[model samples]
Target: MDLMDLSHQNRINTQLSKQKVGKTIYTDCIRAENIKQIVPAITQCIECYPRFHRAENPDICIMVTGIPNVGKSSLINALRRMHLRKGKASRVGGEPGITRSVLSKIQVSENPLIYLLDTPGVLSPRIENVETGMKLALCGTILDHLVGEDIIADYLLYTLNNYPQHRYVQHYELEGPCDNIETLLKEIAKKLRKTQKVTAITGTGKFSEYPDGFLFH
Candidate 1:
């Protein structure tokens, strides 16, 4: 199918580009647009599956699962919009833990008789390493407070430098690429004017208030 061919060529992840897997379909879609493209591919997958093909009208119940904040709910909502011409049945959020529990099935397509189950995001019990966990945390799979934004931001800087992606330097209007997160944060806060006055403890039990730059409002 054209959908499968397009998906196979869409290499979003460099690490997995060479790896081959059977009975799996890859699709890259934006929720606001290209959502209609997903439904046909899904229908094709269901039709190709021998277990579901046995029944003429199979009650196709697809359970969507992935790490938190990877757009599982958003995907369901997009599919619903594309297939059934409906609005959002599943709620979406920027952070993790948006979908609290498994809710009722949402019918996305009528022709293939398909229904989708949106479930809470689950993490693997065994993560490969600290760097892997940090990457997940950076992607917002885990809560920011648990991993700490400072750590994640530092790791991000490291990854960007390692990959040699210097677009941030131009975007931030920096003189050159930065190796220090603190310096970058100060420049960003200065550029965006995201600063707050906070009192600090000084020597000899004295206190002084100074302007502090913060990313969060």
Candidate 2:
């Protein structure tokens, strides 16, 4: 399952009703680690067959494309495992833009003479909207510092509240559904023991704040 579902299924339906989004033609979410489904998924997107039956080309080149951190590299590696019984040929990581160059094409199968061409993840220079950009940042498709963790975390809380996704409330051991993001983050920072000290001026006079330096508190 996705750490965060970017598909926005229900939101997409709403967009479709407003004629803001096109009708979905095809979609499938497969585990990158699942070798069983990888080959079929690859074949569905490209033609793979016995090399002898195919034309003059020495190998069939299959190009993989998607936004940053969308598992393009892992899919190539998984395909290799499923058909070629081999290990990873491309580097993969949680950060965005992990594959930022032309990676060496990997041979996923000998019988079919298939090769996977991995390319750098690219995004349009212009983002359509603020919300879309925030969603991208929340999904780690953009670097955290670029968008700011505080802003991203707040957006996540806003979205969760709008959707009334309370799993996070209980997960963070909050008393209940809280509307304030700062309060929520305070609780999280407390749970994680990530408090830092700060100085503040008060009626009592200038003093160190929270003693424990409770950030977001």
Best by lDDT: 1
User: What are the runs in model 2 whose C-alpha is more than 4 Å off?
Assistant: 1-55, 197-217
- Alpha carbon lDDT of residue 171, candidate 2? 86
Query: For each candidate, C-alpha RMSD in Å?
Result: 4.8, 5.7
Give the range where candidate 1 is weakest over 10 consecutive residues by summed lDDT.
20-29
Q: What TM-score would every model get versus the actual structure?
A: 0.77, 0.73
What Cα-based lDDT does every candidate model obtain? 0.78, 0.75
For candidate 2, write residues 1-217 as lDDT tens digits. Answer: 3554667767867877798533332222344444555455555544434543455665667777878987788777877777777888898998997888887778988765778899888889999999999989988899999999889988988898898788987787878887777878778888877777677888878675665465543
Best by TM-score: 1
- What lDDT tens digits, residue by residue, belong to model 1 across residues 1-217? 2223455444634435557432344434453445666666677777776777655556788898988988889888877777788899999998999999999999988877788999999999999999999989988899999989888999999999998999998998889998999988888887777766667788878977664524423
